[model samples]
Target: MSREQVVELIPALRAFARILCPQPENADDLVQETLIKAIANLNQYTEGTRLKSWLFTIMRNTFNTRYRKREREVIGLPPDSTNTLVTQPDQEWSARAKEVYSALMRLPDQYREILVLIVIQGESYEDAAVICDCAVGTVKSRLNRARQRLREELGEAVED
Candidate 1:
């Protein structure tokens, strides 16, 4: 694909990157880096595949690589960091949200990725399966397991 075509797809790429990277700045950087890589390796792209799918695959791979690298480099926050302060108006809701988020974080990467792709990002099972390079059944199974794990972590009773 040409650079202009890639440029036109930036909005969609940014949306996907936003969910992949919680930080807005990091999402922007990921999108930029993905575009650069796409342009650089344009020759490797197959003509039959959808460009959006190809681009999402590249973005996902780029995010995964960056996440692995960042995992090795940890910067500790000082005790007085503003993030330590409670700024929420509704402390009850905030606490519950934090608890759920913590539970979500505890799930395995495969489960978490599927949940994020299907539930959070509103992608269909087929689309998520394509993005994850798995079958639709695998996506459904992972999502079900992820939800069960989250419930277990949160101490919620599992229901059929």
Candidate 2:
């Protein structure tokens, strides 16, 4: 992969990884593993295959393996239960914004990822599709649905 291509893929990888693992550190680790694996297997990548999708697949696969391992572990054995149920901060600033942000946060992680990719980041429909490992039409449809849900939750611009 070209240096610029790798650089461009970083944000997309992080976004996809974040959806897989909510913890920033775990997401970063996933990204690191993805980069290493992608580079190591770069020769296997076909010229026409979408690199973003390839990277996302690697990230997702890594997360799934980690998740499955965690799931398979015996639950009651861990004594490290201190703060196992970490909570979101109660941001006391601007109640309106906190409410709106919370609503957006409540969006299904899949929808939130699409919203971040398409609307917040202003990525092209095609690029977002590649990052999301879906078709261009699917990306467009998800973006529309996410926008509608955000609007509904924020109670603005309700249309027929």
Candidate 3:
């Protein structure tokens, strides 16, 4: 793929990164890092495949690596200190959105990732499977479970 093509995907990459990282600055950093990695390893990318999926794979891997490293290096912050980072929602919609986002954040990584990839990002099952390195059936199963879990979290009635 051409560099310009990759550049065009920055907005999409930023959106995905925001979902993965939450904090805007961190999301921007993740997108930048993804672009750098994609550029550096451009030769490894196969032609005639979805560049978005390939870049997503790289971003997912990068985020996972950073998460693992952070887990190991995590330091306990003063309990009250966290409150400083949270901003109170002003509007009703904002509050509801924050609630939904919080529920999403509470989901397990795999479930959350699947939901974001399929439900939020509008990725096809086949594309999501490729990005996630899983079978299509696995993607469907995870999506089902993720929806069920989200409904449960949101206090919606779930059908069997």
10 residues in a row with least lDDT, candidate 1 = 82-91
lDDT of 1 by residue, 41-160 (tens): 889999877787788888888988785355223212354665323221235567788787667656787898788776766677887888888999999999999989999999989985
Give the per-residue lDDT of model 2 (tens digit) for 36-140.
988888887777867776676666667666753542242223557633322232457588866766677667656787777665556677877776678989888
TM-score of 1: 0.66
What TM-score goes with each of the models?
0.66, 0.64, 0.85
Clashing residue pairs, backbone N/CA/C < 3 A, model 1: none
In model 3, pairs of residues that clash are: none
| Highest TM-score model number | 3
Instruction: Using TM-score, rank the candidates from best to worst.
Output: 3, 1, 2
What does candidate 3's lDDT look like per residue over 3-46, in tens digits?
A: 99999989889889877775555678899999999999999999
* Preferred candidate (lDDT higher): 2 or 3: 3
Using lDDT as the measure, name the better of candidate 1 and candidate 3: 3
Whole-model Cα lDDT per candidate? 0.75, 0.69, 0.80
| Cα lDDT, model 2, residue 26 | 64
The residue pairs that clash in candidate 2, if any, are none
